[model samples]
Target: MPGTVKKDVVVGLDIGTSGIAVAVLNRSSVAIQEPLGFGFCSSMIMEKGFIGDSEAAAYNVKKALDEALTAAGVPFTTAYVNVDGPELVIRHGSVKQAITRRQVVDARDLIKLQQHLCETVLPEDVLSIIQLDNIRFYIDGEYVFKPQGCRGRELGLSSTVLAAPRRQMDLIWQCLRNAGLPPTTETVVGALAVAQGVLSGVERKLGVICVDLGAGMTKVVFINHNMLYKLSIFPAGAGNITADLAVGLHTTLEAAEKVKKEYGLGLIAGDVHVPNISGSGYNTVPGSLVHKIIKSRIEEILDFVKEFIEELDLGASLPGGIVLTGGGALLNGLTEVAQEYWLMPVRIGFNSLPGEEAPNEDAYRYTTAIGLASWGTGQVYPGMRQKAEKGFKGRIKSWFR
Candidate 1:
């Protein structure tokens, strides 16, 4: 296929565990001309983050990409994609250096500084190092944001590193290639993408946590100073809830999922009353039993999330509170449960792009995919030119290397 670069068109594909979503956007402006196109596929979860059915996954990805590109009236040549799941790993580190009076620093100096920092840490594999804002430069014992052109005696660099298993990344790249699309520029969770799309600048600056309750994974990310401080993904998700319902209700998986969509809630709004099924005798299970089953599964998922947050030692760090997004975020009373568990203010997040028609109130289910596109457009085109440069090269090397 010939490479085509439409000045305004960029595509973002999210290959998730339960389904695949594709979005094509106009990068020059904020308007999303077409909403994302979605394709459903079965995710063969072999392990926490490992996907086993590459052929099936490729088909789903291609279908979504085709529909999205066709809707946007663009053909794929170069596009951004977001990858998520358990394979990726992240860590934070810092480095302190003394600056000489009247010293000049260049790009190489920055690279060397990064290399020196990299040397101190043991990375299972170094995928990318994101330089967080607020590089603290100490000039005569005071911290400053920028020290260039200033007589600084010391510099302190604090940064977060995002890495992933080499083998897992390779599999995703190969899958995308097989589907006739370029590999993703960066692999970020659906949760962080949703956080970027929904959280405000002030909220991020003040420290906020975003929880994305996806189908196969639930991700928690804490952002402060416009950078991620912590992120955790659990294998438990809406799928597990549905599975629990299926087992408890003794119904087919499809039927259980349907029931979950129709009447699912974190907390029962009223008494659980089972409607009579056509083929089965009048449902005998008490409403409280059904409610218990659902609530128990959701609580288990939340418990895992709580444990992860505690592990990160961020209970005291985020003052802006927590924002929830993704399909699972819409569960009735989820915010209340999350607030009680995390002991923070909780709000549900949705896509709010300028000039785009407000999504259906329930469309929070697609938050991650929409946010992936939004983040890709903002980061790849207008926002972080340096980061995009780094991402583009990093993605290429990750695939081929």
Candidate 2:
């Protein structure tokens, strides 16, 4: 029972179209043992980031969560879940607040300024702000790192806001509730969570683009100057490549996926045997053709990233370059191809944060889940606050308004 557990636990749920992943961890700032439990279940209930069937989605979530809890010998009532979907809205805006009686700025003033920005910039009826970043506070017209002592009549704030449609979020909450997990204001952008799991402190501060190449979607998070600069999700991913192979090879999706994992290469090698659409026989196809099909789809996805980079005029500015993770990032020679296309260094990222011990090969699979757990340790979302769970302290303190 939730009341019986003596140790505080942190749970992270990474809901994706390809599967649902859960991580159970000790909620402590110091070094700890490995993850208490980890669980995953293949699911199609979610499609390209949106829940297509609430009933099916809930069932899958429960299946995964139960497995993790059973492994850990602990139970949890809430989890910090990742919100995946293409309908997320990200925008940049600025707001200003006037000081009362021209008094000196303090922590209370800073808090009020943030609250005012949240109220003025967000359309509460249509959109809910999920993450706020790139915030720069100012007194008058100049930037001030420590605004507590500055004396100014006006306070200003500029930030990037990531929001999702209220209707969609409501549906997500309902689905989780149906799974028996109470929904808290605590939530994270999937890509951002992935970055937290895989990126090093130096890498984040130097500037880098973290690309999560999941099965159904490719999510990108840009961190520069130790802050989130952008968050984007494209509707294309490894699943599309599998689909293309399925159609091109006249094979079932299952067979095509197997061929992809076995023979998919960035550059063609030689001919190989491929199973037909039916389970009956095999046929031979040029390795080049397989490469061609895979390359076309991969390029299409990378082109979206390239366009966004150019639009931001971020060319040649990011010293940390690109770090790719997610299931798709496991494809052979993908790093080389990405490096060639962007004319920059590209590397595969795995789960690097502490507290869990996973073989190198399996580390990439749980990158997002580990990151979500890391997000729960000390930092939290701005406005969403709930009373800490029994035996839990400072877990789920971050709230989304």
Candidate 3:
């Protein structure tokens, strides 16, 4: 192990169903790109979005962290992690408080309102809140971005809360602890993290839909006015497509994954030679059949997303359209299929450093990890405040911290 860097260091860890990604960031100057390293390890210890095997997940987490730290030549023991899955619960609630003491809405009123929301609106079951978004304040009935110092008798607040089962969250924390890395209070939703890494501030402000196509799940997030407006998770992803290919072509899962990476196209194209499941010979299959199988699964997944989006009725509001990210986004012609399916402009999400013209091929897969690092460094949007500061002292300390 190398000596840890003395500079301000931030780490981001994303434990996904198909793999674990680790990103180490060292901020020494204006541009913080030259000293960090990105590491990844293939893993199946996670089922959907929760850890299925704590021991195995811990081992893989250590392996990925070591790889990144070794490359960065620095050791770290803490990281901002990402959480998502079908078991996640999303709730929207509002609370109002009467400012009778001083007849004014101040930091105290805001804190009280937030406390009330958390204590009363959330599910009574054991759950860990991973994200608090879309926090808004109002004076009377009019919305206000900043509610402090207002002469109002009543203060109201509303927020979108995301929580995961406490038992599953404990398992994730144990895995990190066993991996020699202690988890922090900073946890981000997987979809929001991807949006942070790939979608520019302008895009978010103008409105955009970010679809993260992971291995076992796909997350759909709608951002407007630079705030996370909605989030939805589905059980289908690129892994489902690979499974379909394996069964349709009579091939092994491994072979199907290989074929998918090597020759999978979103549209019908040239023929493909798929290996047999018996590991004996190869079979020549028409590209159209392969595309049919792949497209069917892809369409099904996106159909759910489409229905969700249509329910939101965001017609013509999202000028930024939709951005596709995750390992599944790497599938060739994915943007094309998504565009045709949604009848809107779509592009692959890629992370790029300042002054860089093009991003590398693997950038999309690590987008969430990168975003987690950004959050650790406090590069957060104004509207994405995690929670209300306790008091004036706490708010002041946070501003300088």
Using all chains and alpha carbons, the TM-scores for the candidates as numbered come to 0.75, 0.83, 0.82
Best by lDDT: 3
lDDT by residue for model 3 (1-401), tens = 48644565677889998899888777544664433787888888888777988999999998988888887777664477898988888888998888766787766577667767766667455776666677788888789867778888788888887778877777877787788774233577888888888998889999899999888999999998988778889998999999999998888898889878875565557777878888899978888888788878888988998997898898756799899888898888778878988988998887764112213666655678888877655442322333442222221112223
* Best TM-score among the predictions, by candidate number: 2
Model 3, poorest ten-residue lDDT window?
A: 391-400
> Model 2, 253: alpha-carbon shift in Å?
1.3
Report the lDDT tens digits of candidate 1 across residue range 295-336. Answer: 888888888877867877874666788787777777777788
- Candidate 2 lDDT for residue 166: 68
- Give a tens-digit lDDT track for model 2, residues 288-332: 888889889999988988876776687587888899899998888
lDDT (0-100) at residue 156 of candidate 3?
86
Give candidate 1 misplaced runs (Cα > 4 Å). 1-6, 30-47, 75-78, 95-120, 125-157, 266-283, 308-319, 354-362, 377-397
lDDT of 3 at 357: 21
Question: Lowest-scoring 10 consecutive residues by lDDT in candidate 1?
Answer: 380-389
* CA lDDT, every model vs. true structure: 0.61, 0.75, 0.76
Best-to-worst lDDT order = 3, 2, 1
Model 3 C-alpha lDDT versus the unseen true structure = 0.76
RMSD of 1: 5.8
